[model samples]
Target chain A: MDKFTVHTGTGAPLRASNVDTDQIIPAEYLKRITRHGFEDGLFSAWRKDENFVLNKPEHQGVSVLVAGPDFGTGSSREHAVWALMDYGFKVVISSRFADIFRGNSGKQGLLTAVVDQSAVEQLWKIIEEAPETPVTVDLAEQIITAAGFTTKFEVDSYVRWRLMEGLDDIGLTLKHVDEIEAFEAKRPSFKPKTV
Target chain B: MGRTLAQKVWDDHVVRRAEGEPDLLYIDLHLTHEVTSPQAFDGLRAAGRSVRRTDLTIATEDHNVPTTDIDKPIADPISRAQIDALRVNTAEFGIENYELGNKEQGIVHIIAPQSGLTQPGMTIVCGDSHTSTHGAFGSIGMGIGTSEVEHVLATQTLPLNPFKTMAITVNGKLPAGVTSKDLILAIIAEIGTGGGQGYILEYRGEAIRALSMEGRMTMCNMSIEAGARAGMIAPDETTYEYVRGREHAPTGADWDAAVAYWKTLPSDADAVFDKEVIIDATKLSPFVTWGTNPGQGAPLSATVPSPDDFTDEVDKVATEKALAYMDLTAGMPIRDIKIDTVFIGSCTNGRIEDLRAAAEVLKGKKIADGMRMMVVPGSVRVRLEAMAEGLDKVFAEAGAEWREAGCSMCLGMNPDKLSPGERSASTSNRNFEGRQGPGGRTHLVSPAVAAATAIRGTLSSPADLVGSN
Candidate 1:
């Protein structure tokens, strides 16, 4: 995981709700065992249309996404997050996010910032009107600032710390191996084993 | 205060806990499939780590497996490579894998319970969203991402925050022909897609108790479509009987002891939940989705709703977009929407019982002319069981193709897929845009409704087939 503190980038306004994982990275691109090179698959279906948001000239190379409510609402494929990051998105601002998608974002260091619908609307307005205006997402301050507008965002504190520090989750959990073994020792005898 | 079933299960799995920090919960089972796990295994190799508990983890090849022509090599090179990666990774890590052509090979969720690996009071995790299908046994089964899959493989545990519990109480007996799929679809329609966010749902009340284990699994399977990470039903004789003599189920004294512990796993009578929703199951009819999302549905008897019907801006916009993508008109009868294909398989409704129900509806009746219907079982086991019951002949004689098991056409990973602009009445979970294939449209339906729709060339329910049969 790469450390994330304050990232400044242009924004793309995806004015659609329930932008599910299937739309983000279709299942066709999931055949690759490796994670990189998914940039082409990001919104592959919608990108074909000349009028879609991401295909606009001004929104090219944008790293901040101001999206509708309930973004990433379906599927647990982390490929959704990878595709966003691979396509140059560092921060996704939405009114709400699916639980599993949000959790996956924390692990992968793609910042999912939760704000009220009003904030989302304002951000969309700012980004759509001036796509090149730089937006800064500050994890330390828990706020997003862009084009003279600022709004506080919500994120799990522990996740915030890990993101800022670039900590590996497996390493953090491995620190308590002894406690895990202790629990396993007390587990009931009837629990089925795979082998 | 008494704790809800979710809280009780969460408490039991805690390995470590502290203020301001998520609890370290022990995982009893980890299910994996080919699609989302290859990268996780690659990460472990890069990090010089090995699987911590192979005894608690199992893998299967489903998402990319070709359902037909079982003996031939996979026609898609990329798909074959992914499956090969899983075969190699599982062998290297010493994890048990049921690969393609294996007798036990199937969708991960379908095989887990059928083998008696899923039990009450356990915590199960998988990389697929439909892991909630296992929660029918009073367990906490959640879907995770590739990173979490790697974490679980390395440690057999997850750090998690507590979840809020919501009681979805469905009272009254479900009317005839109103299956659990209809009941759950109706629930999701009422709640909207995001209604269950940040909550674990517990299905309770008389209506839930009346459902068979397969029905309960169908209900829990789609909890994700409503934004719930997991959904559960308390274990009872229904659950026990389903698990009693499967391959991995406890035997002799172990079985007795397991049942004793399971008896204590249900929520106490006075247990309180963070939220409660009550529904009269008697009012539900055969349900189907008319839009891209599962929540965008209504009873089969209703008409396509106009965007003007929604006051919420997001919902209104979504409805308009859905109507356009689905090529549907407002005020059009749902039953009048025509379909080109009918897919009958997935983790949702691919069990033997599901096959039987559909076969019963198709018996002695042919699907409408030019209608393409495929009956792909969830697993080889399910296919074998259906064959033994002579359901395959029924499906074949009715003009539906009886195919091998795997997640065929559930998603677009395999060769079995819907063509662009094609429409299907599918028994799969999602009805998302391009879910079956690019530019493909899917309407989620139960197996029975799928069969009936195949015969009618439209979104019809089993009741419409009564006189025809």
Candidate 2:
């Protein structure tokens, strides 16, 4: 995972609420074992239409997505975040994000910033008015500024810290390996064992 | 302050806590399926980490397994590789895997409870979202992502943050002919898809308590549809009776001790919640979704809602998009909608009781011509139990296809799927665009609804299909 802090890029406005993971990356493309290179499969179904937002020519090459409230609303697929990251999105700014999707994004160094609904509306309007407007998201300051429509976003301090430092979760958790083994040793025998 | 059932379970699971980090909450059980485990295992192997506790982990092949052609090799190479990868990975990791033809093989959610592995006061996590179904037993079941899957595999614990509690109290007696599926659909419609976000919703009040174990499972199963990561119900006599004497449940003195501990898991009378929502169950009726999302639903008698009905522009746009995707029109009666297929199985409603409910409606009725109705049990054990009672014969006589259990047609990972532009009245949760198949339309309903629709060739309730025999 890449370390993220103060990324500047053009924003793509996809103002769809409750845009589920199925819509993000359909179930058919989930068969592969390799974790990366899902860019083509991202919104594969929606991309068929000539007028879909991401398929529109001007929106191409944008690395930041400004979606509506309650984005990434269904499924526990980390592939959704992978698709976004693989497609060159460093941040997904929304009014609200599904819990699992947000957690998954945190692990992949993809920033999911929760701003107020009005702030999201502001960004969407600005991007719609000028497709090439530069958007800057600063994790340390908890603020997003695009076309002078600046808003402070809220993120968990721990997640913010990890994103800024480019931490690998599995590696971090491994530091507590002794504590994990200790917990396993105390587990009751009645619990069903896979072995 | 007294703790809610979720709080009590979460508080008890804390093995170690630190001032600056999330709680190191121990996991009692971890479940795996074909699609999600391979990557996590790869990550583990890449990092040279073995599973911290193989005893707490279990795996099954569901998503990619062919339900109809169990004897033949999987024709889809991608799916075949997924199943094979799961088998090899489990064998290498020292994990127990229930394979396709095994009697215990089925949907991970269903097999866990049916085999008594799902117990009260336990904290369960799975790679799939529907794992929330186990919350019916008073456990804290969470749907986790693959990175978290790797985390649990390594640590047997999650660095977790606490969630706010919401008491969704459904009071008053549910009218007859209304199933738990109807109750949950109505709740989602009332609260919208994002209502339960960031909170653990506990189903409480008179109506929730009166539901059977199967009913509670169906209710908790869709908690994800309402945007809640986990859902809970207090442990009671009904819960106790269901967990007793199952294959993995405790025996003799162990049984007594387990029950004693479970009895203490319900919320105290004065326990507080972060929010409260009340529903009068008597007002609910058989429900179905008319749009692409679970929140776009109405009673069986209600018509497709107009975009004009929504006050928010965002909601109106979503409704318009959904209406276009579903090929529905405003003011059209929900029951008048035609369906190409009726899918009567998934982790949501493929248990024995779900089968029995659909069987009662299917006993003497022939399915309408040109309608494709298929019943897939949640697990092979559920199929065996249903056959022992001759329900399979009744289904066959009624023209509904009976097949081996898996998540057949739920997400369309297997051979069972609707062709493009096909619409179905399905018992599974989620009606998202292309959820069943690419461009396949879905209407979420209960088993009874699925059976009646299959028999009538349209969206229907049992009341609409009377005298079909």
What Cα-based lDDT does every candidate model obtain? Answer: 0.94, 0.90
True contacts kept of each: 0.85, 0.64
DockQ of each: 0.89, 0.70
Candidate 1 per-residue C-alpha lDDT over B123-196 given as tens digits, one digit per residue, 9 for 90 to 100: 99999998999889999999999999999999999999999999999999999888999999999998888989
| CA error at residue B157 for candidate 2, angstroms | 0.8
* Quality class of the docking in candidate 2, CAPRI style: medium
Q: What is the lDDT of residue B54 in candidate 2?
A: 90
In candidate 2, stretches whose alpha carbon ends up further than 4 angstroms from where it belongs are: A181-190
Clashes of 2: 0
| Superposition error at A51 for model 2 (Å) | 0.7
Q: Model 2: per-residue lDDT, tens digit, A86-139?
A: 999999999889998998999889999999898888898999889999999999
Best by TM-score: 1
lDDT of 2 by residue, B75-104 (tens): 999999988999999999999999989988
Best by lDDT: 1
How would you class the docking of model 1? high
